[model samples]
Target: MGRQCITEVGLWLPSLRPGVEEWQQMLSSLGQLYVQGVKVDWLALDREYSREKVALPTYPFQRQRYWVESSEGSDKTTTKHPSATASSPITELLDRGDYQQLTAMLSEKESLTAVEVVQQLIHLHQKAVAQTALRDCLYHIEWQIKPLDVASEKPSQDGQWLIIGGEVTVTQKLAEQLEQKQQSCRFVKELPQDYSELLQLVQQETELPLVGIVYLNCEEVTSHEEVLSQTETTCQSLLELLQALLQDESSNPTKVWVVTAGAVALGEHPISVAQTPLWGMGKVVSLEHPELWGGLIDLEPSKDVESQMEYLITELLNPDADDQIVYRREERYVPRLVPSSPSTSKTFKAEPTGSYLITGGLGSLGLKVANWLVQQGARHLILLSRRGLTEETEAAVAALQEAGNKVSVMSADVAEITDMERVWKQIQAEEKPLKGIIHAAGVGRLDTLEELTPEVWEAVLRPKVKGGWNLHQLSSSENLDFFVCFSSIASVWGSAGQAHYAAGNQFLDGLMHYRSSLGLPGLAINWGPWAGGGMVTAEAEEWLAQTGLETLSPELAISALEYLMSADQVQVTVSQNDWSHFKAMYALKRPRPLLDLITVAAERVEAKTEQAPNLQQRLEVVAETQRSELLRQILQEEVALVLDLPITSRPNPEVGFFDMGMDSLMAVELQKRMSKLLGVNLSSTLTFDLPNIEKLEKYIIDQHLVGFFKPETDEDQQEESFLETNLLAEIEQSSDQELEGSIDQILESIID
Candidate 1:
């Protein structure tokens, strides 16, 4: 071979050194020989293999797989090395840092060369890359609103202000503040419930062009009725007002500022979470109707009326795009997205002192989190959802329970505070104070601006915003290590159709900030489209692909979350986007300040190597003899991409995918790509049913393309032709007497 860079030298070789055990020494020696293309005798180890067998596995065959080698079968061959010698003392070895001596220590038995250590590291890095492809390499884009302090600007560009839905006292205080600044204002005690009337209120309330509309209607909630009532004020009311403002013929551009007192938590002060929905919706409105939309202003809960008014006036008149503002004391705060690095630290251990509560726990996302939580040492779990413990969810619950966890399944809505309170009481009664709350309860459908009916909007908002508030209110006193909410990327950078969803997720981000401000444990993850069964429909998923948005694998998304929980972050957006494709597509719209703050989700650009057409189409032209091989090549290419291997390094046609670092999440990913490629909805258990490329290829052709194309020769006729052509040859190896006896037995059976 010409001189070429050899970055890696080991593939199957295991490093060998002094003081190693006999079984491993033999294994490593065999591994070393195998890489050098030396074949070992397999029959020589047959007896040893037989001695190691004790019992069969209980789970389904070919389902379970992992990286670490098992020591179960090593007992037979495990023994102290006969000619081993102890290496130098570790301290002495460190002092010298001798390359050859260190190698000698690693492979005392074989005297492993220094080159082997370098080779092993390269080999291990390959394994590390494979593992990262499934875990460390996964990330999603998130928009964090980092707080920036600034001096208040003087009032300029005066216009009349519209104030809607506030108590008489607060409204009067605000109106007086506007008057002192030479600004005319009007106050509506209660916003009109009807949409047409909201149109009229905006047109009739202020005579001249309005400077801004301030809505301060969010209040503390005590029941489900109040949750809906508050959402109507914060979400529905704002929706109607923005629509009316846009439809009016001559309404001048006015910033519609939503002010909520004690609605968002910045420190540990009380939060009127009922107002939080406005923040979620405000972000959406900022995108959908930027001209008519103002920004979100969260006022602190305080009894000092004069102080509150002074700050409120200062924020309203300040000229800037500081839309997402929070006023606490004399300080003015705004949000910016800061790039974050995910941690692998062991600091985020799930404390077993208190039970974990997962709203929407029966849903797929909730269950995934619950399973991860258990793995992190959580002992007690309360899985609360509207439809709790159904046929499917019950099985998952049973599995968690069988694993020695206390899993309580409750069929109650998290949106209903009473229900959550009842669940809280039961947990407290067991002396397990709630340690963490995962507010995953959310429901939404894709709809354009016109399609976002009041009913549709409220239905979507109820679960996430109202439910999040309920969790926050009920768990205020709990000794919790984390209060995480599952937010969507739709809010971070507005989704065209999902205005309400963006709104709900926006509230989650605000809630985390509220918690952070108050010195409480909180995290809101603005997740991108997820691969595992999430809200993204097949059509939507296809669209996502075209837009260069990668669906987040469940394994990666959850692992990223566990790491982020330990991070000092109030909010983080996790999304997988091909920066090359995403930025190109996103450029169709005006540049969003939020997108500017996004660090590229991943440095690894998606490989554009899948050139295979529909399998059936490819099979139609290929000869029958070559069909199996052709399909195998195509499948192996797909599998290799998922395994993060080079295309030329196609996996063995007969080796298992799971054995090649393809976890269930990767399996899900492969199934998705294969489904799209072949135009068939493959089952999620596709990998298990057909364990290897050979089996998978055969299954695909047999099941999907059964009669789509004709074989060159009929299979049945080919078998008959074989028998006809080789009648004597078929029995040539059999003894004459045995053949005669077989004929006589057949004749006797026929006669009987």
Candidate 2:
């Protein structure tokens, strides 16, 4: 047992000879060899009774999830349309209302007459409409606390724990907790400035097989300046750790658990918003390299750890296939998308007196947000882009100006302080102060997990991570109405082939939370792909559609942005998908606990139907005098519950629902609550049309009639945003700034 003693274990004893007893624990070595599939002679290698004959399970013992491309040789550029889609046979039949043919095709009632078929189709339609309410809006995820029972001993507790962070007291406590369970942990208290050095540090620390890498190096960051500093230090450390771990594929997979105190608000606790971005980063890591990924744990925002500490140790050792876990005092939580509506905040309108700045303003999303600001009667709007305006962009700017808004296009790189400083100088020069900032400028690059080098990390991380910092730093002193960042759903839910993209958006989410924690006006909307423009490529949009996630149309996207201007929450993911189609992606792939929301939502709908009924009939039976007030009271309470406001708070009768804080979350909840109470199905947008208490009550009295709804759609046609073409072309034609400026002015004059 010369080499096998170190490589394979339980073969050599502590007394320098082959013996079974006397505190000679070679359990970690055996576990590493067993998991690695390196078979060892049991009786030959050790004493007869020393080795335990363990029972193996029918399913694989290794509980970690891994995903690969199941749809091999699939086209990224084309959407797979079935019979129900735009060009499908079902569409033609449905559009024409050809009930007889459809009934003949789908039903066994071939003997039925055309009239009967029509009657059957009408009945089917009615049935579908009544029950589709919850199914239509069940993908929204929120956090819920659930108790977990972790056993005293987990069978697969091998390898040493490596905690990478400062010598903070909480980290020390975590290490002690790990060792208490007879596990070894190493402390790498400092990280170097360079990636190679960071990699070297990991190599030196993990000579033996590693059980997990615990990252508890984060501190509470509340200011934008701290965001800049921490992005350089803290964010880089996490990236370096991941890069290093990927390089070293040890015998036993070394999973990473990024722990943060106050990174999340489980209940009514204040959060260390700066630490939240790591969740976004950790999500991508889990997706890109599931083999090296553990889950993310957020302890209660406190130092005195009791049961939360116990829960942490248990979760670190025995994660229940859940990637996101939170522990509050005596309570445990996992994330799931519950059927909550998009939220509404206090009503906020663009100020005519102050200027609004849109960074990356030349990009599609930025331009649209600028146009939206103009629609809100915003007088002076400044658009910041690093690139000189191209011909199409010039035309777009002219159109914005034609709408009687001062839309200035300034050239400045958001990541560079000097460039941002130049732009900031001009912004301060304005007669009116800058009121709001929308950071929409970012680049999208396609790289597989292996392709994500440190340079790639820098390129992708710089804009959102660094640019976000610059904006935060420059405007830290100003009283901004809204400091909105256009984060992406890629960060919230890990996207394939978008590792860097997810990381960047994740940084924005974290930055927003940090700002919000500091009592600043910050909101990060984790948006899905925009339909017509911005960073969405044809291939990407097709992929998104294939996954059942709809690309958010610009009109709809902007309306949401406008509505959530001052939303209560710092970070929120905004996207739409019917769970019917979206759940199929995960069917063959890895488990997503967040998607457990769809199940919960479905159960809730089932319970609602089974538990109670006939609310509307009961109201009619009551005196007509009290009917209006009762319905109104129900609406108020439901809205309040969804918004997380006081249950007693009521919406103003004259003010609009959105104005009184109604978003998709409140909207859907109100619809469900009303549907259950009225004993009839109400559309999800019941509040959207009947926006006030008077309108809502009137509609309720008049049989819960829904009003006309205009969908927020974008141009059917789409073009690639600046990252692919304009930015590159401008970089080559840098000497010709004069032509670009003249073209913009001329375009504006012609429009005028």
Candidate 3:
């Protein structure tokens, strides 16, 4: 047998006792064990090993029983006893201090025991390395604690297991398998206060095949007397605790176990009776002790329905599953409902009769919309501007007259009821058949609450809210054919510094709702910034070029106008081109039917999947779709006044192109597009289905929708003037102040 060293004791045994008796006993046992072919080279011991107390003397290298012969060594031999007295300076340092204090005290000393000095330094270095490793582990633990979803693997190293007794047993196993995998073992001890230290010791020994933890007994739980009763509870508690630990996101175990009473149970099992809402979960397999409190087992599901959810749960519970968990996000796919043609039409072919009234006609958008109306079919154009249409108005009027449309200019503040009444009278006396009214008068300002005043609020609200009501009053006359109001998009998305502007716009939105409820034929177009014009242009350009956000362009603005004017629609809110469907669906002030139309309109258009193959067919399609009894009657009157077309002749497609020559296919397509225009479903097949012109005419007459159409006759025009004036007066008399409070209340309800 060879002499056994205590310098490597700390590595082999988790806790190193510095008592002389323990070290001597261990040393003597290692010596006897070495005679039985055990090879011992180094030992790990603490500063307590340097204490002075012994019952025997050393013969240095004699290798006798437990004590060695010190002076009898041949040469170059050194030995250190737990009680050995030192003469060298370095030994003097270790004799008075522990490893750390010794290094600090020996910095100035030299020429000491080389082996002892080097061994102390090595142990000190190992301590530092161990401390750093432990700190790193703690740091990882803290990080995992934050999300509780992250998992980490323990260090993979050899494991050392120590049994404490009169004659203890030491076992060396693969640290990886021992610390993390399904492991089997027995112990005579219970749990301790310094549980982490115990766990750390076992973790350093060997790696477990599955997830593992170490337990220590703080003198109390370690009593052999408590081991029997606690055997089952300890095992149950341990199994429960291990199962719980396995569910921890920081450390997830693949295999589970209960090792006690000289037996090891290894398998998969559910942690508890608590049900998990996992899809396709399987049943739990029973354990042996069914009569006693039963332990839980694993559940397996056959379906893939719960795959992603189950995987997420598993990863969350055991974030330490290496690279097993992944996170990803997907975007929603929403189709855009953009129009094919974007550029405004070069010019329109028709004109409105009598004089046209356009409030805020001096503003950029007001001017543009008014100009477009003139070019379309308006013969009489009236400009009602704040500055009374200055040099710009004169130039615009000249352009209109040159284009063959008459122009009229009037001065009135749209927000003033008196001014509105004055202008209404003047128009009625001078322009007896005033046909159109365009309320483009409005104001927009940017001011925070600190800067906002009652005057500012009144100024913003007057034009859009009060002015809208007043304009409605003034325009509500029997002679007026169309009433159009201009609104802004800021009403939908409240701006930071423009609360007043938003309020004003929202007021207009409500007015639109108000009018539609009254069944008034009106249009309120909430417009986006027009291209190359208005305050929005500069702001939009600055934002896009400098910040990358977008603003509305003219094409989108004009498209909104098209929906408003062409459809005779109200509460039409504009948006950036990308939000066509969304804004039309959600942000607009139109009726429920409008949203329903915007939703299903594209679907209807798609229903007319095929188009006319040729240009002539396309023209025929348009004409046939527009053909109705009412249109035919108007055409008959117009032909008599212009060209003498044979109205009595029954139009027959079978004959040569003489009898109105409208094809059946073209007629159906025409009806589809016309239905979109009329906001009603009018079948184009009516042309072919009701081939009798007289019967078709009666159907159109009986529908009476033509009465709601454009006022064509002199009598119809007169009735409009009467109704518009009376309704305007009535609306003007009714103060809308309650509306603001109601709107706020409703909005609060929505938010709550």
Query: What TM-score against the true fold does each predicted structure earn?
Result: 0.53, 0.59, 0.32
725-749 in candidate 1: lDDT tens per residue?
7976756666756676889997787
Q: What is the lDDT of residue 484 in candidate 1?
A: 93
Instruction: Pick the lDDT winner.
Output: 1
lDDT string, candidate 3, 1-752, tens digits: 11265554422421235665776667666767667765554323333455754322111111123455575522211111111221434444457776676666433556667786686564444333332222111100000111223346443333232221111121112222232433343232334334334444544555542232322111112222242233223322333333333234434233322111101011121111111100000001111111111121111212121222333223322433121111212111111222222233343233455677777876777677666676466677677777775765678667767887766677788877788788778877874377667778777676653355557756775676567767655555554556767766554333445555655565455455545555665665655444565556565544422221234434334434543455533555453322223323222111111112122334343232133122122223223333343355332322222223243332432332214544322343334434443345654234434444454445654663444333356775677699889877865564454444666886787456
Candidate 2, superposed: residue stretches over 4 Å from native: 1-141, 151-153, 168-173, 192-208, 222-226, 249-251, 265-270, 304-309, 342-348, 566-569, 587-589, 599-752
After superposition, the stretches of candidate 3 with alpha carbons farther than 4 Å from their true spots are 1-351, 537-540, 544-556, 577-752
Candidates in descending lDDT order? 1, 2, 3
lDDT of each: 0.68, 0.67, 0.42
- Give lDDT tens digits, candidate 2, residues 662-752: 6544555666666666655554446655777788777765654333111223421122343447766764565445555767886787456
Q: Residue 404 in candidate 2 has what lDDT?
A: 78
Question: Of models 2 and 3, which has the larger lDDT?
Answer: 2
Weakest 10 consecutive residues of candidate 3 by summed lDDT? 277-286
Where does candidate 2 clash, by residue pair?
141-337, 340-665, 341-664, 341-665, 342-664, 342-665
lDDT of 1 at 715: 79
In angstroms, the error of model 3 at 13 is 65
Better structure of 1 and 2 per TM-score: 2
